[model samples]
Target chain A: MVEPLRHVTPFWPAFWRGFRALMPLWLGIIPFAVAYAVTARAAGLGVGETQLMSLTVFAGASQFAAAGLFAGGASAWGIVATTFLLNARHVLYGLSLARQVPLTRPERVLAAQFLTDEAYGVTVVHGAREPGGLSFGFLLGAELSLYAVWNAATFAGALAGAVLPDPAALGVGVVFPLAFLGLLVPLLVDRKAVIVALASGLGAWGLSRVLPGGLVVLLAGVGGALLGAVLVTRRGEA
Target chain B: MSVPLVTLLMWLVTYPARLLGLSLGRLKLPPFWLAFLRFVPVSVFAALIVPDVLGSPEWPRRLVGCAVGVGLMWRTRNLALGILGGFGAYWLARLAGL
Candidate 1:
């Protein structure tokens, strides 16, 4: 019965589905990438270096941090240290997604290059819906589209330079939070998920007032996940 | 100190964390750990977003955009439309000088 459905939908179809699934996320991604480009350029990075940073570093928050530090006349080592501290959440993301999508070392290495918060969110949501687990084709499709959009937006912003106006002034900065709200709505399917999400959100916001950098998010997420696991185990035993 | 060297160092510090879990994929995690991992996607996203929604500049406009976004997603369950609605609301608020 399911055989025909499986045969009809091949690897390419899954890949395309992944691409299309990420289309909505472009709302936030476009503005953020453009902001990074404009900020990097304004911070005295040449066009080549600005583009290179987007292409290689690929982490949005860290890129913004690095650009700000550079513009402030911080030392190279200072910029690197600050950016590294801001990106430590990626380790948590990688750990969460590692088992969900099994792949060989080489493929994993390649995929790691494209693992942004947005990519991971979309991949895991899609994975949960499909019984067969996460596919490499789907991951590739989603990541590649995000990567392409980010790089292109960066280039456009860099080329436009100061003429582009501030993305924030135009209300573009709201797109990220709005887009995330959209993503979060669909994931709240049960009591446990809601508790975990709410706890994590509140914890992060509270900790951000006192702590520095990305550690707030990482610690909050870990705490929420641990709480969720215990709740699930208790429910199961009941 | 050079731009290229700095870029290389940035990549070195960042990419390792992204790749570490994949390299350790062969190790089997306990069931409790796996259950915990399942909640991570939502937790991570919530952690990323809530701060911005609560603390963004131009509080009134951002609040309106967020309300519209959540309302649209709740009513329609369409991600693109919800985002577009939020973007439109934000632009409207800005245009109104809010």
Candidate 2:
């Protein structure tokens, strides 16, 4: 093979570019991953199970929700229900990314595997400038780096699980809620979103008094989103 | 269900939803639906976070942690800062028996 300018190792620039793009976000992601593993351990997930979920699901919020629900002894169906809603937005990410970057069928499959919120967001910004930003190489790089970092963090946190003393005494009890709190605040983008959050958050608190906790989350999510949609429509054309 | 089963179930739901998105990307859904979907993350996150905060035995501590977290994250827009700051506040509060 003829060597070209700047082609020594033969790695695609876009791939490394995507990896670098995602590297910065991992600083925010590590604690969340660690918290997940610690919470999972507290929730009675074996180390194997915790690693397996991170390995498979890869979505952070829903994994935390599932761990909380598992600690609360929610049913399997409840876990599935929450996971579905939490991840339903993945479809939108795929749609948006596909619109931005024309991906082949195989590319679609692989990209979907790595199409996390962070990966999607970073790639979107790059896609605007770099032709290869949202390409498969980019996604592979960004997502794989995320995947590796997340799993490694989970493992480290799992070890911390054994090391950290009783959950309540060390104030570890707040980690789960704190983790979700960090995620929630960022999503409050506008008045409509804020209202939806308030409505749903209050709904969850109230429903927790009577309903199962898992069910409350599901109901609040659907009800709040519906309310937001109605408000949007009433205001004007979407 | 067992751990693997639950994980499999989540995967079953997630992958298909994403695949459906790619196929349906060609056809734009109604604008109202799009707006609705956009709000789903906030709604879902609030639902997940609030009940956990309100239902805790150490709610006062949890709320303090949450308030600081929300404030810092909203102000700084830095996730790590928010988490660590809130966590530090929580640990201090817990130690002081708050």
Candidate 3:
């Protein structure tokens, strides 16, 4: 009995570490948040509405894609579908993570609401280190900090959007893609990973124009994974 | 769309998606898929960031920012530094009218 309580005591500290670890990451998010505002505003979302979207949706990539689609004259359903497809990866995250932390039906429902990239990263890293050792406080702390930083940057971005000149004209649009590329470049640590990343990026780039919907993104992801499997199997045989 | 309404809709929709992820399903996610899931953050971040960085007019300015970001990440291996450095450099370059 006492052992269980003792095991839980370090959870708050773990959460704090996770939160502190996240602060620097938020800096990169500022531009993305600002871009979201520019697009959201162009999409006919009011300043307040844009803020709400950031606060609520909280998935930066999905929001940007959705806003871009909206600005491009996509209907509400189309925007929603785009959001779902862009975010289908989250489903994969939840599925992989479910085995580690077996949440009750209600807790699973609640936890789903806050499953951002930051949360997923923290959960996986920490969960791996101390499997079954993460306390609710730890998860909450990491997630809440991410929530605050994300929403705050978004609010700032929307405010900037209401007054600033077109971000596209000023070349702020380039910042978004560069930031993403910088991230992707680091993760290609192996031949297989590199192949997957390149294939996916290139496939998506080419297919985005011709493929209806985000079939390109889907294809890239699937293609990369299949390529990885084949590579690993060949290596195993050797 | 109203802000609160968007928030409400998110709460309504995202929860179910999360729930669906957890419920035992027929989806036979393989080991490779599981490994791929680990990289989703990197993929998602790249997918989101690449278009804007390469899409802008002042490529030089954004390139400097990218250089700074890479340097920061190499030095510290801290994701936060990389992201922050990149954003800061870009903002500073823009403010300088570069």
Listed models, DockQ each: 0.66, 0.52, 0.33
Off by over 4 Å in 2: A1-50, A59-103, A114-146, A157-161, A176-189, A209-215, B1-10
**Candidate 3 off by > 4 Å:** A1-9, A38-44, A65-73, A99-104, A122-138, A157-161, A165-189, A211-215, B1-13, B22-68, B84-98
Give all candidates' CA lDDT scores. 0.81, 0.76, 0.62
Query: On DockQ, who's better, 1 or 3?
Result: 1
> lDDT, candidate 3, residue B67?
73
Alpha carbon lDDT at B59, candidate 3 = 62
- Give stretches of model 1 more than 4 Å off: A1-10, A129-132, B93-98
Ranking by DockQ: 1, 2, 3
Better of 2 and 3 by TM-score: 3
Scored by DockQ, the top model is 1
Q: Lowest lDDT 10-mer window, candidate 1 chain B?
A: B21-30
List pairs with backbone clashes in candidate 1.
none
> Which consecutive 10 residues in model 2 chain A have the weakest lDDT in total?
A1-10
DockQ of 3: 0.33
Q: For candidate 2, write residues A131-219 as lDDT tens digits.
A: 52346677677878888899999998887887755545656556666665666676666788889999999998998898765467667
DockQ comparison, 2 vs 3, better candidate = 2
lDDT of 3 at B66: 78
